[model samples]
Target: MYYVTKDLFFPPVSQANRDGILAIGGDLSTERLLLAYKSGIFPWFDPGDPILWWSPNPRMVLFLDELIVSKSMRSILNRNVFTVTFNQNFRDVISNCQNVKRNGQTGTWITNDMIEAYCNLNESGIAKSVEVWQNDELVGGLYGIDLGTIFCGESMFSLVSNASKVAFITLVEQLKKENYKLLDCQVYNPHLESLGCREIKRIEFLRILKSE
Candidate 1:
């Protein structure tokens, strides 16, 4: 565990504790966030808590070629019921993700400061968003940092069943076309696993993360 200060620096990822918390207390400036992501680190802290930066040992990632699209998802894609757009209405997307209530969590990690920081990244074209619309009404969306080689997926939300899935699947397809190295999912969860996201050793993740 490392305690960050006013400096814009972070310790090596190898020094992180078992839980992947590398360092704490760094400003969410666009420069720092970009440096963290490029170094295979990301900040995830609850409101009122000090900032926590993480670089998990078994990092969850989606290899572009290994994305799993279920038959049902394929059917939905073919139906064309929802229209998908990229980098459109990003603030709305992140806000929806911020407000969504998860089953195990009482609050959102996407705090107000986080919204402004990432939105700054979006304005600089370093962050990107995917919007899903049904008949011109936004129903689902996702946002993340785009590193050209890798996309660091932060969060997503859906107002209806399969809307977020639609956004995710479409993003995967587009990323594949763009020849992105992989989608960095950060942590493990059933939902991400269902989409063919798997854990890789931190060393391996860093290798790929820097190979670009």
Candidate 2:
């Protein structure tokens, strides 16, 4: 494991441990966060823990062509029950993600400092949000870093059933329209896999991120 200093740098991704933790104890400055995302690294630590940087092997990703929209989701999309928008109410979207409870999770990683840092990134147009609304209420949404052709998804929340899925499906369709190459999901989860996200070698993911 490596330790980050104030110099705005990270060790090579190759040095990461088996669990993909490359470093610890870094500030969430905008510059540092951007540098980390551009290098295919991201911070994921418990609220009380110091910042932890990871670049996991077998990275979880969703290729635009591989996205799976289930029959039920297709029916939902066709119904037009939810209104989806991008970069709308980013603060609320992320705040909801921070507060929403998840199964097997006792606390949130989206600390106040992390929220502030990502909000700064959003204002600078480096981070983006997708919000789902039923009427005027924001029921679900997600936020992530926009690395040009690749989007590094950070977190998502759903206040109602299938709301987050709607947001995700809409985001993927828009990204496909824009010719995005990939959506970096960071790690594997059964939930994401059900939506067509799959694991690829970390080196392969890095190649895609670094490619022009």
lDDT of each: 0.94, 0.95
Q: Give one digit per residue, the lDDT tens place, for model 1 in 121-180.
A: 999999999999998999999999999989999999999889999999999999989999
Which pairs clash (backbone N, Cα, C closer than 3 Å) in model 2?
none
Error of 1 at 51 (Å): 0.6
Candidate 2 wrongly placed segments (more than 4 Å) = none
Residue 88, candidate 2: Cα error in Å is 1.0
- Considering every candidate listed, which one attains the maximal lDDT? 2
What is the Å distance of residue 101 in model 2 from its true position?
Answer: 0.5
Cα lDDT tens digits, model 2, 1-212, are: 89898889999999999999999997999999999999989999998899999999989999989999999999999999999999989999999999999999988999999899999999999999999999889999999999989999999999999999999989999999999999999999999999999999999999999999
Model 2's alpha-carbon lDDT is 0.95
What TM-score should be assigned to candidate 2? 0.99
